[model samples]
Target: MEKVIEMKGITKVFPGTIANEDVDFDLLKGETHVLLGENGAGKTTLMNILYGLYQPEKGEVYVNGQLAKITNPNDAIKLGIGMVHQHFMLVNNFTVAENIVLGREPKKGLKIDINKAIKDVEEISKKYGFSIDPKAVIENISVGQQQKVEILKALYRGAQILILDEPTAVLTPQEIDELAVIIENLKKEGKSVILITHKLKEVMKMSNRVTIIRRGKVTGIVKTSETNIDQLAELMVGRKVNLVVDKEQAKLGKEILRVENLVAKDSRGLNVVDGVDITVNAGEIVGIAGVDGNGQSEFIEAITGLRKPESGKVVLSGKDIYGKSTREIIDSGLGHIPEDRHKRGLILKYSLFENGILGLQHKKPFSKGIVMDYKAIRKHCKKLIEEFDVRTPSDEVNASALSGGNQQKFIAAREISKDPELLIASQPTRGVDVGAIEYIHKRLVQERDNGKAVLLVSLELDEIMALSDRIAVMYDGKVVDILDRKDATEQKLGILMAGGSLSEAKREVKDVE
Candidate 1:
């Protein structure tokens, strides 16, 4: 196989940080090359340079054995390279076809020809084995399908090199497997690929050659089959990494979070959350398992004081905090890990130190009387960054400078570090890398073992099962059934997820037992 692309000695410097230094990367024709690194490593920076998002201070790029110069995204695309970013770039109101052909639309006489564009996108999708609905609105399609549209867009632009950035971050296990097949198909069809991810399993399973980056330098490059995950971790972090977290069994305590006939609705007055009753005991973890939009949002909102239930009661530590203000609820000792990081978890413009104290800094030991203890706040944030492994150049750096995985860790560290009596963690590990997921899982479970109540809601069933002392399957706004960890099965949970009765669920749960 011939080398399709090569970048050597790439170095990118910011105000006070060298994001990449002497980074070497190569992509073979019709091969999937995986990039592996820790959160703050220079992997993304190197890719950004390749795609023209950054102008490397010193580097040389080769395409098809010929030296190439890519100064902008347009230049990269012109050279048959396309990238699907970590955050999607589709417009909400645009149809799938519209989004796919956004920058390069088919013209009919003077304007975009809608009919021709849809047909072209559909044809390209079929050629790529992507069953995307071209006419469907971007907001109306599944994340997986939207990703296919992104791929189709690249293929439509005649890109021979496809760069997928965390493509499976939001996908289910089934979807991840499906995407792996798609990647294989793309490679078989002679399309070169660059998969940027922190997932060691994917690197070992999918890529031919793997490159490890750490702190702005190339740590090592090796054949996928020649190295184990532990070796890769050491290369990425410069130390022996304990991939698995160790924790003892939990000791379940009295009920700390109690909900009785909770009926909550969105602003549209739709009963998104129907009559639901659930309880979480101190020193226990209760996981809510459901598909997206199955009342998980409403349930969390009602519990976290973001939204008030229309009917029924919510008691936190035996007190009705249902109608309490958001501040009041925080004062009552409930920590919430919201699903949307940008919208709920971070103020990107603020420094990492300040963003760490957004919600709870006013409390004792952080603020005194009328002024904030700024030095104390910085110290606390530094400890959290170290403990949670949040990657950043410094605490003075803006939170937005942190990568997606590190941003998620910041949120998890902030919400979980408090060690509150009751914690509501929704999609707590979303967008985080696999290594960090293991870390966050250990911490959440540790909280449970320490006699704190935890209400965890996640779309990942594996996570729910792994951490939950008890699993509550929610469907159509209610917990269809709650099963013991010892007795729950994926098959039974799937049935209950579709609105089966608890008796039926219990029977299925016992079958697994």
Candidate 2:
């Protein structure tokens, strides 16, 4: 193997923190190398340096065995290096071809050549085994398709070395498999790839070599054929980790939440959540399993009062909370961990102490007659951080200062501290590392054992299967089937999630038998 990218003695520092220190990383030609680490462990910082987004404090970069002085993205692109961010940078209303060739468009004499742009995009899509419509609008496409467009953008720019950051964070299971095929195709074309992700399963399945980074330095670099998930996890977290969820059987109690004939609409005025009926008991976790955009978001919104239901019954703790305000709903014994932590969970600009008491700002101990007790608030925030293991310097810093995983842990700590009777945790561990995932899972189970009703909504089937006492499969805004944990399998859940009825799923199994 030939060395394509090499960084020696790389050290990047922020104002008060060392993001990366003396990190040595290398990638070989035509091989997929994985950069695995916990959030804020300097994985993205290191890649940013390579992509010329950030200049390193000290280090040397070599491309094709020649020293390179890349200072910006344009310089990196000129060197055949392209990066696709975790968040897709695409214009929603523009056509795929337009977005791909926005800056560097093919022109004819004096005017933009739109036809040539589309033709070039189409040709590149075909070369990479991608099935993308260059003329389709970005907003109208699925998330998976949008991701392909991001990759195509990089490929169209003549990227020989591609860096993908958390590529599967928002994709469905089927889309993940499809992406695997695409990666194989890219490898067949003899392109080197650097994958930055926290998914151990995907790391093992896709990469030829794994480089583990802990804190700000490389801990170990091993061949994928030799390392298991456990070894990789331990290397990243600096300790032995429990990858499996451990919990005893639930002891069911009275119903804590009940939703009957729940109907809700999306921003487009269409009934996305149509007539959902379900119940969560006091001492159990009832997980809703479905692909994203299958009415799950709307369903959760309808119950949480984030969006008003068109028509439905949302009863919480024997009281109908149907038309209540979000605050009233929260006061009515409901603790909600929203899916989008950035959008709904925390105020990025506010101090951690302030975000800690977000919804409860006007209530007792935190506030006295409209005047907040800063002392109490700081104490509460400190306790949440210490109890939840949210790694941070101080409560005085803004919420944005923490990494995604630490922010998530802060939110979970605040919500669980409320001690609500019915806790609605939506995508609780979506982008968290394995160690954080383990801690979060244990907390959810502890809540169940403490006689609280937990309503878990997640797209991760492994999570649904591992954490739920009963699994409820949702399809097109309806509860297709609710199965006991002992009776549910990934195959059966997949069948139901794809809009097949419970009877149809059973019949298919019988046919196979």
- Which residue pairs come into collision in candidate 2? none
- List TM-score per model, in order: 0.91, 0.96
lDDT of each: 0.84, 0.92
lDDT of 1 by residue, 488-509 (tens): 8788787788788767866777
lDDT of 1: 0.84
lDDT (Cα, tens digit) per residue for candidate 2, span 113-201: 99999999989999888899999999978889999999999988889999999888888898899898899989899999999999999
Per-residue error at 419 for model 2, in Å? 1.2
Candidate 2 has what TM-score? 0.96
Best by lDDT: 2
